[model samples]
Target: MKTTSTDESSAGGVTPVAPDAATLESEKESMLRQPVAVWATALACVFAFMGIGLVDPILPAIAENLDAGPSQVSLLFTSYFAVTAVMMLVTGAVSSRVGGKRTLLTGLTLIVIFAALAGTSGSVGELVAFRAGWGLGNALFVATALAVIVAVASGGRAVAIILYEAALGLGMACGPLVGAVLGDLNWRGPFFGTAVLMLIALLVLVVKLPSTPVTGERTSFAAPLRALRHGGLFGVSFSALFYNFGFFTVLAYTPFLLDSGEYGIGLVFFGWGSALAVFSVFIAPVFQNRVGAANTTMLTLCGLVAVYVLLGVFHGTPWVVTVLVVVSGALLGVNNTMYTEMAMSVSDNPQPVASAAYNFVRWMGGVIAPFASTELAEKFDPSVPYFTAAAAAVVAVTVMLFTRSAVEVHGPHAV
Candidate 1:
């Protein structure tokens, strides 16, 4: 009897190992079941985004306690967003040289340092300056976070983008609730809490995230600016600039309108953030698949315009204002998801370069609108800020309509 050491077929040929059914099932797992690195990065993303709305619940508290005016307290957002906007121009340059993972860590470290410092601020000016530092950290992380997620996530780009937006929504939703809880104890608590949460995220990322290899390619500081030559990218970025004016008006100015105290304002915006999260994750894809990305963006921008108009009309009625704020979150979600997809896909420029370019432009709205809205409200009335935002929204819609052809993707182009 001749016994073969190797497992051979009856014909004396080696039998290949067949993958098990379980192995195939694992291979086909859904987007929810991602790798450790993806989850770690996404978790960090949630914490990072929380910083956006963290101050909303405490805006009134800060203004009252610090003995500062609405416009002065509003500078918190002004300084933060202004720094964030400027930093976007160089994120690609930094990340390309040091690599994505290190860049993320560096950003996280800055946030930890700045958030703690912000907690100890004795005046609005000090707080605003520290918040600017936080924005610097946020820009580095925010610019790199999407790229890391896209690079590591399974399924596809659509799934990855959705995940990133979901993180944004969750962070936004939770930010106010957390701020209310902590800020009620002391206005400084939220800042310290943010520092702790970010520190945890930083440590988790260091362990779970694998190193990203340096490609030895350095993006110039002007690379993001040069990316704007693409008609599609430029169209998306320009329209987003005006669109954000309306969006930030809603976010930064509405707290004073609510005047509901810390907990009440927190709950209201929590509901708003929840709406944003739900629509961006569940509803945005449905609309995009039905109407196409550019069309969806325009439709949502129109919806935002109507919302702003209603806000202007009902500024005196707190109930109506609250309801409008929640509803606007839904429209904002759709627009945000569509705008991001278009910016990433619209041009052949590298994803980092495109994001840096797109953000550099769009964030200008965030920089201007917060203080601008407060100043408008001070000079005229609360309704005037909403009206100003409505006009900006109208301009946004017109710009998109004119540039629709440049940004149209696989969807129908009726807009």
Candidate 2:
């Protein structure tokens, strides 16, 4: 007679055996073993995230070398993010037409060329123009990368997202260090450095990743805008807008506040970025798991307000300012993760369309805050920008509070 395995039961049996420990462990391991194409895309994501903080340590240097005012120099961020926000509208349209592989290559090529051109610029205006082109490339790459990763990765969308977030956190943590090391030599060094690294990523992606076939109907240019009409998506997008104003204010303005040199500034921000990485990857899940995504978002926004207030009050003390900046990173990390999860789940629209709409709206805050913060410091007081940022955080908290029911119905909690 044949013997039955643990997974099998006799006819008319009343009990079933659970999966054995060895089988469960094998399943867990399979989730981590991604294909080569997934790894290549994830590597590219790291380089892309690094670009966000790559200029932080060099901001003051750029100003001094180019003989530009704080407000004018801040336009570097304004130009970059403004173009990125506008380009978000067209990314899905273009990607659906060209297919993901070609789209990735096109975006990477643009970044390589524009970043190199930015490094060669002698004037602030020239740099700003090149940065705008770079922003457009970034918009294309980022919007498509997620869909590709999820399509290719094993263990489903959740695993792919975790890999993406890990790349983001690691890149963010390292960007300042890379900038400081290069920017210490020359302000243009970081720009050139980015170009070189992205070129390598481009090469790896081209060689290793197979071409992804275009599937489904093409996305419309107006799809993202139309997605925003949904109340849940609209609420999350606008709430993130207010939150991002505070986030970018701190990120773009704090270098000027510190009297420390390039290396010191990089070290301080490294600590900040590391804290952000830790909280985003580890702590955020715990908080969201316990309190739910909506409540966690509100709590983090309140934490940001408190941190910004402390920064404003202790503006004169370098040590205090540095400490608060690092602490603020944890708050930012939590908010970023929660907002992203909420945006993805909060609407009935296609996931890519919802993502594009959310990004387009929130990045507008990034475009505004850097230039506005510098102008405010020039006109009113140095600390006014932080106070303004605090106010923005308050607005975010208020929005979340009012939209709590809708957020719960449509947010990560629903998953």
* Deviating ranges (above 4 Å) for candidate 2: 1-31
Every model's TM-score: 0.92, 0.91
Global lDDT of model 1: 0.86
Highest-scoring model, lDDT: 1
Candidate 1 backbone collisions, by pair = none
For 1-415, candidate 2 gives per-residue lDDT tens digits of: 0112334322321121234556435434755798999999999988988888888888999999999988998988899899989888888788788888888888888988999999999999999999999998888888778778867887544456556776777777788889999999999999999999899999999998899777788999999999999888888999999999998898899989985888988988888888887887667766876687889999999889999999888988999999999999888887777887778666667767877898899999999999999999999999999999999999988888877777676565411
Q: Model 1: per-residue lDDT, tens digit, 170-287?
A: 9989999999999999999999999999999999999999999889689999999999998888888999999999888888999999989889988998988899999987888668
What clash count goes with each model?
A: 0, 0
Candidate 1 is scored at a TM of: 0.92
Give me the displacement of residue 325 in model 2, in angstroms: 0.9
- Give the distance in Å from residue 33's predicted Cα in candidate 2 to where it truly belongs: 2.7
